[model samples]
Target: MKIEGIVLIGIGAFMAVVSVGYWFWSGEPSGTAMLIGAVLLGLLPGGYYYWWAKRMKPRPEDRPDATTREGAGVIGSFPHGSIWPLVFGAGAFLFGLALAFGWWFLPPALGLMLVAATGVTTQSRRGGAI
Candidate 1:
């Protein structure tokens, strides 16, 4: 039903049909190609089943996606998100300054950048989580 499964099925069917056609038309080469095609067809269905089973199965909490209830859709935006953008800009400024000056300032500047990026990401996710 999923797109990946449909694609695999279509590919498998196509390969199988082509292989059969070749077998009737040609000789040893066709037989080799048929073997390869049949192998591919078998693997495709096997992979599809494996993925389906994985999706159908469930696990305990403590997984990153355990609490993810709904599909990933658009969430509400943070009204004050502009502040985070400015924070990121300041971090970039500091980073650039450190680069121009010396390597000694690089660590602090990188730390600032990391903090700014983390704050922005966390704030955005928190504001948007539904």
Candidate 2:
């Protein structure tokens, strides 16, 4: 999370700096306005990182053995052993590619994939072998 915050701040600061440079080079009101907007937005992530890093602390009750400790509900709930995720991801990619490339066969292919995925998911839910 801290790394994410830093990355956000870095991206925002980069946009602000680039906008400022563009404003000076192009002498455009839009660029100057964008610079101000980017800077304001950039401050948000930076401030969030500072506040979170300083304010957050691990309490005694937050230990791993605590019943309410992080991710307690996740234990033994489900094993990370599903192949459906890969199938769904492939279907999504195909769908997106079809949408982008305007292929004639894409729509029907995507629909078939969706139906197959639904069937597989139902079977899994019924405790049948995938």
Candidate 3:
């Protein structure tokens, strides 16, 4: 986590410096905005990982002397299949359509998202399809 954080920060910082130079050269607000966004793309995750790295005990991968066994733990069971993702995609598609076409699609879009959220939550809690 620490290493990941450092790398991300470096990436963000490098982009930021370049963005400053580009801003001065081109004097284009749009270009500066996009470059700053790139800076944020790195800084956000980097800051999160670095914060966690500081809070928790060192992870096995971070230690030079650590072995693979040091990181041993039970792996979690993943969901085999679920329809929630399709439901979400459908909702998102409708939402986009609403934004592009008209406000009438908003209701169905919101409803589908609601249904998906309920189904996924129920499935996780009951360990079965909803």
Best by TM-score: 3
Report how far residue 54 has shifted in candidate 1, in Å.
28
lDDT: which candidate is best?
3
What is the per-residue lDDT of model 1 for residues 1-130, given as tens digits with 9 covering 90 to 100? 3444656766776767777777677756847676667759755785776588567643323244655564355555646434656766777887888779877777777777788788877776767621
Q: How many steric clashes does model 3 contain?
A: 0
Better of 1 and 2 by lDDT: 2
Query: Is candidate 1 or 3 superior in TM-score?
Result: 3
List candidate 3 segments past 4 Å from native: 64-68, 93-106, 125-130
Candidate 3 per-residue lDDT over residues 32-63, each given as its tens digit: 99999999999999999999999998878888
lDDT-wise, the better of 2 and 3 is 3
lDDT of 2 by residue, 26-121 (tens): 899976886878776876877697568567763334344645445344333353466666676677778787878878648765876787699677
- Give each model's whole-structure lDDT: 0.66, 0.70, 0.91
As a whole number from 0 to 100, the lDDT of residue 94 in candidate 3 is: 100
In model 1, where do residues sit more than 4 Å from their true spots? 1-75
Residue 25, model 3: Cα distance from true site in angstroms: 1.4
| lDDT-better candidate, 1 vs 3 | 3
